[model samples]
Target chain A: MFRDITIGQYLPGESFIHRLDPRTKILSVLFFMVGIFGLKHLYSYLFVLALTLTVILVARIPLGYLLKGLKPIFIILIFTVGLHLFLTPGQILVEIGPLSITLEGIMKASFMALRLIFLVLFASLLTLTTAPMSLTDGLEKLLAPFAKVGLPAHELAMMMSIALRFIPTLIDETDKIMKAQKARGADFESGNIWQRAKSMIPILVPLFVSAFRRADELAMAMEARCYRGSEGRTRMKQLVYRKTDLIVTLGMGSAMVAAFFFL
Target chain B: MIKIDNVIHTYKKHSDEEVQALCGISLDIQEGEFLVIIGHNGSGKSTLAKHLNTLLIPSEGQVLIDGLDSTDPDMVWNIRSRVGMVFQNPDNQLIATTVEDDVAFGCENLGIESGEIRARVDDALATVGMAGFGNKEPHYLSGGQKQRVAIAGVIAMRPKYLVLDEPTAMLDPRGRQEVMETIHRLNKEEGLTIVHITHYMEEASQADRVVVMEDGKIVAQGCPREIFSQVKLLKSLRMDVPPMTELASILNEAGLEVDKTLLTVEEMVDALC
Candidate 1:
């Protein structure tokens, strides 16, 4: 059941969007997010929604898979919509008991909800199209300039990549531990909130121990491979900006600027 | 080439209850030698292997790799680059998400150019029979495949010697065979020195030389045939001899005319026939 969650999952595909450089995809998402926040009118929100749909089509990600990623955020979206609906004061539209819904409130809530939805869709599209390795590579390259100012960008990126690499491994470990505990008559499901938290101790302790052992071994292996900070390290897959990347950057920049001014 | 000069390693050296992991070990590993070290758990085989790559400096003595002292702080990286080490768990050693990237890890650490790193990654992957699996995620790979990728990661650095500490201990029989074959091929075809630390007697029987450790000391060292022929000594040390060697010894004890030196089934069959 835990495997059904696919928020940061990458769906491999051969498509125009998938072929774009990771930097291009990352920058495009950034611009799209900015445009989403800048939009004041409903038409602009629809335009952004249409733009997200076009990206989804180009990436060839299955609609069902993308929607599955939004499942965890459904409650957050509902809460945002509900907060705006009841709190925003405007001309009255409906009255139910002590609650009053207004025209402006409805408009604001729907727009806010659409913005949230489009934000998630665009972000998911980026991860769906680009592999996690490329994403970290892009992040490292994008942050390389900050390293000159005493920031440990390379180390941060390395940590992120390693964390991503270990997610599935740790998940498998968790599943195994959970099953082992269950076989030993450990109840994880039948308890209050505090009791459920307490029940996790058995699983957490072993997992933490194994994780530390893995970290120690990994550190030794890395040292054996001559890893001595990021001073002189070189990457095999050098990130290069191509013609398509430039075009995508220019197009996205123009669209975002247009959304801010014209809309 | 590597030399261990009376190396004594103690864990928690400053503590009163320090445990001696390696007790007065001395050995020499020549270039292009396929040396296998076999021992029971906590016999200090891994501790000895770690000394070869400077992962653990000796508490009393010294380890020298290619004439450079492993204990010297300045030569640590140089020694590490020369003597690559692969650990038991493939999942832990593989730091990169993709196989190719992991293979490129050592080269990258050496500050090699991107083009050179790319070539080395491809060549190393091909050497490990994982040529087309460059882009595959390491998590999705089977145990055998992951170990192969880990070997590729080490070999990509073009190390003169590869020290594997029970690399196949966590693997299944198939995975063990895969890793053993890769190690042997690297030693034979590439002329790379291999210091393989393993618990499998069959693996040790195939090595050019075998060193048996007991209680953090070398109990015996000889060719596989000579080593396995001493079935009583090996058994006394709580280590198993090769299956064929054990069977041959049993047959010989039963008044049958069998060669106790046989390390493989084929050799046993020839001796019987």
Candidate 2:
């Protein structure tokens, strides 16, 4: 059950999209989002959808993964569609005794749903192709200018990378603690909501203690290696832009700009 | 060389019931020597191993690696770099998701260049027989493999001395063998000084020297043959002599001639049969 819940959702591959510089991919995703929100017409929405689908295909990621990414948003989608059909103000397309479905409401709801779906899909595409370390490194380089304005870009990126690296480790810890509690006959299921919540205390207490212990260990380990932060520290995989990065950025930039006028 | 000069450690000092974990323990460990330390729980063996790498400082004395004092603030990094530690829980010591990444953690902390880090990581894993496991996630690995990976992490740092604190206490029989073999290989082939603290009598039997601690004091120190031969002394200290030694003693009492320091099950069988 936990395996389905992918964190940061990185799908490993050697596709052209995966090989693009993380900086370019990040900027293009931002621009793609702009195109998503800029769609004021149905034609524009279609264009954005086409562009997103093309990128998804070129990424070589399965279509099912994108749909799975949307699973959590299903409730919101249903609620919005229901409110638009029953409560929105517009020319009524269908009438019952107390409920009327309006054409404008239908169009608005469809547009909203489509926009949200594309937004999530585009974000997934970006994460699917880039590794978490590369993403953080790219952010550090991109945010270098902000350091001049008093932002600790390197430190922030370092924090993010460390956090990313520990997610899987922490998840495994949680699983172990849960299993341990389960072995002790701590009832997690088959209880009232309050009882279940109380049952979590056992798991949480140990998890918290172990987490603190691990943080202490990692800190000591880091200090032992003489980690003094970014000062005088050089990385092995230095970030360098490639030709594909520029081409992808230019392609996406023009598409977004074109989306504004033509659609 | 590793030297401990009157190292004393106390826990919860300032409390009415303060505990003295180590009472002026001193020993000299030569370079590339395999030294096994055995003691009952709370005997200060763990505390002593922690001092080898500056994980804890002696309250009243000093620990020196190659003449650099562990208690000195400036040399803490140098001391730790020369003496790497692996703890009991393989789960806790392993900090990376992938086997290779976990091994590279020590190298990363040393701030080694990427190319050198990669090479050292591979070499470390290869030494532990985990060469192709660089990309495999740590959670999926067995207990023995996890411990080996932890050892690999320490080895990647290329320390002169390796200190393990009951590392096999958390493993099964198979895992225990895997880790013991790795430890032996590092000591013998790589010529690394090994200070291993364990409660297992079998593990200590093969050490170049065995040190027995009792109530924060060294009660006995000698080679395996010398230490295991003193069966009565070990039992008084609340430690079991090797099983073969016990069997040999019983056989000797029954008027049969046998070596009291037989270490392995195979050796015991050969002597009896």
Clash pairs of candidate 1? none
**How good is the docking of model 2, by CAPRI class?**
acceptable
Chain A of candidate 2 compared with the true chain A, TM-score? 0.90
lDDT of 2 at B235: 84
Candidate 1 deviant stretches above 4 angstroms: B13-16, B247-259, B265-273
Which has the greatest lDDT? 1
| Candidate 1 per-residue lDDT over residues A138-197, each given as its tens digit | 988888899999888888889998998899899999999999999999999987999999
Against the reference, the lDDT scores of all candidates come to 0.90, 0.84
Q: Which ten residues in a row have the lowest lDDT in candidate 2 chain B?
A: B89-98
lDDT (10s digit) by residue, model 1, range B5-90 = 99998877555788999999999999999999999998999989888888888999978888999878999888888988889998
lDDT of 2 at A77: 85
Docking class of 1: high
Model 2, CA-based lDDT: 0.84
- lDDT per residue as tens, model 2, A23-124: 998899888888777777876776776778888888899999888998887898888878876788989999988998899888888887887788888888
